[model samples]
Target: MHVRFTLQIFAVALLVSTTAARAGILRVYPGESIQAAIDAANPGDTILVEPGEYYEDAGSIYGLRITTDNLRLIGKSKNSHSHPSDKAGQMSNRVRLIANGAQETGVYVAPAGCEYKNSACAEELQGFYLRGFSVEGYPANGIQTRWVNGFQFVRNVSVNNLNNGIYPTLSANGLVRDNISYGSLDTAMWVAGSENIRVIGNELFGSVIGFEITVSNQVQASHNKIYDNTVGIGLFHPNGAGNPPLPVMENWVIEHNHIYDNNRPNDAPDGSFQADLPPGTGVLLMGVSNHVVGKNRVANNGFVGIGILGWCSATTGTDNSCETRPPISDPAANDNQISLNTLNGNGESPPGGILDFLAADLVYFQLEVTVGAGNCFKNNKPEGLTFVSSAPNGELPSDNC
Candidate 1:
């Protein structure tokens, strides 16, 4: 009986090992392909890339693409060291994924050719972790993820990526932390069509919109330095020439961030969503709901420090109605609370042009299709001066919730 029990135990161990793919480390030194190593690794494996400049654009997809579940792609093993150049990847001690304009994206993580309704595909393709790499000069995004179930984007660098630096769309349950994104033609970090995501502890600059959250739900953005962009931290709901908007863009929290000096010229192409953005706007919440903006230091912006506008007024160029027309995205700011923020030295210099109405410390004047309710800004800095530089008739609420 004792011999039989020992045999049974050994048999169980063997079964367990075979059923679950054994995890291992795959290393790629200089001149080797990181994508090749990733292709060879199993689920739950870690790919360690050595410090060097790599110029591979993994055929038709990206520099590196990840599909295996629980895969961790790490470089340099430490994030304390940073890229020497801020706007472009001049050099770095970490692994550098150089696009050289041949690649559209640096790294992409998604389940390839998987049916959305398949349970097994969902189980097999989830959870990717990327850290410690400098991806630069991509014609498109430096890092892009779509439909990934869970992800951790930590300590990566993106420079001179044209459209977006780090863009995660249609993904869920992700944490984006400790990253640097700069010199994008559009937004630096764009979390669109995703849910349950947090963007924290990053530096975003030299873009049209620094950090933009669009068509998403349940996002928390905090502890970031957002500056030197056309607009800092845009909560937008896209309703034009894209996917269908999420219902109401609900449950967001923006807190404890140092948002200042976002006075850069708008370089986005015409007819783009951010092309009409007024430079020096601190935080613009457009036509979304259920937010708490508190405990942030918003300072030195040239335009409105905290601006709220219905979609119609900002985009349609009409001021009195929320656009009931077709493609009517939820353009009303509803059910938001703004309180206890340090607002100073803002809106002293208004960016001129067509958006001349957007110059103030706090503003809420929607001219088109306005049925917004339960929005108020209270307890901001300088005591009773919250409404001193607001829209006409103090439309930005001081205490009227």
Candidate 2:
């Protein structure tokens, strides 16, 4: 039975490889519309856009809308290469997609009648690859993908996008790597309601939040340079409507990232939840569980290096500001592990609201009377590495998780 199952898997893999090999490549030139080529292409086909500035504004909205599945949108430059590293090095020759103030999103990747909340529909839409392009000047998002599976967004540069630079919501099993994203009013890259998504080797700066994992599970953000944002990395569960059915954010592993100097003033739009985030925050984990923050070099921020807090504690007395319907039954942060991180020079001057509560290295605030188990911290390097807690003694138990 095992041998037969293995052979079936091999046969399926071979069929997929054969199909991809047979897929044709469609080329779009400077004057030709990219959407036209995309509409003309079939599934598993490749759209090679030549090196030039392409303005995708269709009367009321902006940029190209991709509804097709298994499509690879690649930029063809003078230095066009297959690998992400080589493409990043030759960014000067990339095919640029400019929104030109008309559109909310530069590239919108979503098919009709299939929202990300439907796991079956999301799983059916697979193999979307976007690479080697510069997406800029969108009012809302640079590249937004909803409910896509097995997607690859690599070697892309997103700048001056208003809300999010690379926002993938309700997606699963994707790779967002080797990207440079900056100048966003909100998060540079936000993975919301996603699972098994890897955001690695990306540079995110000059945004409200460098990287955010919201209501997402099983995400791994590693080796990314996060700096010059209001908050370096944020893991939170907001009280918003229309969120995915996933009730809790869990099992996220953030490791080996350079999180530093995230002191940029909050520039998110007024009335937006992110505008209220405290600046100079290195990593803020609120209302999240079963997460690991390890092996990171967190330094030189004016506020807390790493903050773990419950939902109520983080946003107290803010009427109608948080999600109400979901009713976070247990808002206390629980079962989190922080280990082996290099923390230094944080909380030099904390923000106003949390000034008295700030700690240089790490701070934990649990609003609930009954704390959950297995929140541990250990083996972190020493450079003013203090752990401040809301307990009576202002200390926590030893790390034994």
lDDT string for model 2 (208-299, tens) is: 99999877888999999999999999988645223544865678999999999999999777776787788989999877778999999999
Prediction 2 TM-score vs. true = 0.88
User: What is the Å distance of residue 52 in model 1 from its true position?
Assistant: 0.9
lDDT (10s digit) by residue, model 1, range 204-317: 988998998888889899999999999998887566324467674687889999999999999888867677778988998877777888889988998878877766666665
lDDT score at residue 34, model 2, on the 0-100 scale: 89
* lDDT for position 89 in model 2: 42
**What C-alpha RMSD separates each model from the true structure?**
4.6, 4.2
- Report how far off residue 396 is in candidate 1 (Å): 2.3
Local distance difference test scores for all models? 0.78, 0.80
By TM-score, the best candidate is 2
RMSD of 2: 4.2
